[model samples]
Target chain A: MKQRERLIEALLALSAGISVLTTGGIIVMLAVEAAHFFRQVPLGTFLTDTQWTPLFADKHFGILPLVSGTLLTTGVAIAVALPLGLIIAIYLNEYATVGFRNVIKPLLEVLAAVPTVVYGFFALTVVTPFLQRLIPGMAGFNALSAGSVMGIMILPLVSSLSEDALTAVPRSLREASYALGATRLQTAMRVVVPAASSGITVSVILAISRAVGETMIVAIAAGQEPRLTANPLVPVETITTYIVQVSSGDVAYGTLEYDTIFAAGITLFVLTLVLNNVGYWFRQKFREQYE
Target chain B: MSNMTRNRLLDGAFRAVGLLATLLGLLLLAVFLLDILRTGLSRLSWQFLSALPSRFPERAGIYTALLGTVWIMVLTALIAVPVGLAAGVYLEEYGRKSRWSALLEINITNLAGVPSVIYGLLGLNIFVRFLRMGSSVLAASCTLALLILPILIVATREAIRAVPKTLREASFALGATRWQTIWYQVLPASMGAFLRELFWPCRGRWAKRPRCSCWGCWPTCRLRQKAPWTSFRRCPFKYSTGFRAPSRHSESTPPPLLLCCCSLRLG
Candidate 1:
């Protein structure tokens, strides 16, 4: 019996050990490669410079363009996804019958299950073609098309999270709004949306983080130009796309060119980590209030 | 028109807009399934399933990718299940109501939200580079195992927490040790739920493999006709998730047809 008890304890310890090791090892590798990158290119050059031509002969290493491109695509994606996602959540929670919600929810989940690569293909084949007719000279691989498809790709995240948030808002709140002679839309837009603001905000932030870290879509659809422009129609590149471009190239090990990918990765990692923490904090706070 | 007429018009417009939004969101799913079926189904004969990715796209079967996915999935399940179950046990039974446990609880919830691609980068650095696993299937599988680790942990914890405390007290009163009480009484009571919690994420993780399209969806589709027991009895935990055993049933297979239509559109 003592031996059996010891075995269980050992298993518990073992799991914790594995989790910590995995986290630790990832951080260490990122740090090691980043250290190598910083040694070759000064920290100021990587962070503050505007141009990011690593593959060229004159190898400029300012990361602003990549950062802006990531922000731009994410910005456009949020603009498209958030309002639609929120409205869908509102409709599902406040207006739809239980039967309707059940059907819609699983379908939305199926949307989430579709791989990001498929979205890239959709952007390339379907979205880009549609957009090119509206905006002339919209490149085959423009950020706008990629951003729209990405918005669709992460729609489930926003809608599902916001729906969960909206569902958590007490029924009494909606009843009170209705008792005040508010319309259904008013009850949704004013009372429920405000009540669920924190959760919805966290969901939006989480979506932004996803857009920022997304690799496959932007890699395939968003062009590889590291321009700092905010033009949505023209081709633009993201940090993740830049990383893919560099990695896909024939850079030898330990070169500044190779190290640039790690530098970009660190930037991507830090942004996502911060956003994830913020999202988590909101979810916790909101959940605590309701509980 | 009267005010009543105007109000009805407004409601109709709102409903129309809502329906349109829902359809818009669901369209890609339809398009995806339609696209895959249009392209892949005619070509997905037995020959295709049994073959591997060839240099020629025409001859490219998903055999290696499928086997690799299965191999990775089996390993991920073996590695994640026991550890996740144990962690769940710890959080649910041993540490319930503790402040530290609550904190860990929140952390796990947040951990599950991190993007899959970030997990890829994490895998590239941690498993492939640091551990020298290269870009082999093993590294990818381990990466995914860690990716879904938090989900399994949270689900199992929820399952164990759902077990009645009365069961625990009963065992303790009968002179059972804490571990014995948990293992024999609490766990067995929650066993069905635990299996379910483990299976969903495991299935998802397997499907998330870079190479393979999921087969779980296939069994849910056309294959259930021959072996009605295949869906539920094949995997006990899957039964609770509304996967009715194919055996001992009527001659209908409506759900799989619907599922196939859905998968066809969404693929």
Candidate 2:
């Protein structure tokens, strides 16, 4: 009996070890290469420089331009996805009949399962052509097109999370609001939405993190022009696009140019780590329980 | 009367917009599938599927990528399935009420949310660099294994928990050992549910066509069927074109068992 228990325990330990080893290995490797990067290029230069011409002799490595571009596209994606996702979530969770939601939810999930590269293709083939007709100089590969496609890609995530949060709000609260002669919209907006506010906020943050970390869409659609401009019409480079570009190019692994990818990766890693930490805290702290 | 009619108009407008949004989402999917079909149909011959990637633009195919994807998924399922089940069983049976187990459960949930590219970084370090796998199929497979392990364990645990506890009590009363009771009573009873859970997370990955197969790969020609052309040949019917897949497999190896496994999982 003791031997059997010991065996079970050993198996559990082995599984946990796999998880830890995989996650830890990533952090350690990034840190090693990123440290090497900092040694070659000053941390101040990497963090503060506005220009990102790393290959040239007078290389300015301030990552702000790339960071700003990422933020701008991410900002647009969230702005578009959030309200639209909320409306869909409200329609499904608050008002829709079971049959309607059954059809809509799976359709949305299938969209979510479609790869990011597919979304990039949609942006290139569909969104870009449409946008170019409307805006005279809208470049073929610009943040606006990328962000719109990304917004569509992330719609399911935001809606699903928000729906879960909204559903978890006690039915009794909505009932009480209705009992007081509140309209369906009024009850949902006043009673349920506030109660689920923290969960909804966390959902938005997680969706933003997903947008920030997405690689293939930005790599394929957003051109690698790291200009520090907020205008979405112009081509701009993101940190993720930069990572994909640097890795896919023919640079030798140990070269300074190659190490720059690691550095940019580290920066993206730190940002996502912080977002994940905050999102984790919100989820743990605000998980609503009902009898 | 006016206010009521106005309210009705507003409600109708809102509902229309709601329905339109839903249709728009569905239409996007339809358009995507239509485009893939439209482009890929002309190239959907047996030779296109069987041929290898070639620098000669006309001779390229997804043969290597399809093979690589199969290899990776098969190895991933092999590595992940047993470990995930055991860990899940341990958590459900032995440590169900333990605080550490709960903490580990929460950690796994969060880990599943981490981006897949992060898994690429992890694979680069642990599998490629540390283990010297050299960016081969093994590294990619193990990386994906780690990515799906947490999800598998969670699902497995849920399945185990859903098993009835009365059977365990009944077996224990009949002098069965705890391990024996769990093995014979709990595991067998929950086997179907376990399989259901095991396959769900992986369905998305398997069904997805690997992007490496499509990007920058040269196009290969598909068979173009020629209509039967003859004057005074057909009595009353018009000729039509109907292309068919090449009846050949000698040049190309058959897809591995893993593709079959994916179909099984989907089933």
Highest DockQ model number: 1
| TM-scores, chain B, all models | 0.68, 0.71
The DockQ-based CAPRI class assigned to model 2 is: incorrect
Q: What is the lDDT of residue B106 in candidate 2?
A: 60
lDDT of 1: 0.66
Candidate 2 RMSD to the correct structure: 10.1
lDDT of 1 by residue, B96-188 (tens): 677766666555654554455556667766666667766555665577677767766766766787798899999999999989898799888
Error of 1 at A100 (Å): 1.1
**Candidate 1 — which residues are off by over 4 angstroms?**
A247-249, A285-291, B1-12, B96-110, B198-267
**The TM-score obtained by chain A of candidate 2 when compared with the true chain A:** 0.96
lDDT of 2 at B178: 66
lDDT of 2 by residue, A130-183 (tens): 999999988988999889888887777777677777888988998998898665
User: Model 2, stretches more than 4 Å misplaced?
Assistant: B1-12, B96-103, B175-178, B198-267
Q: List each candidate's DockQ score.
A: 0.15, 0.14
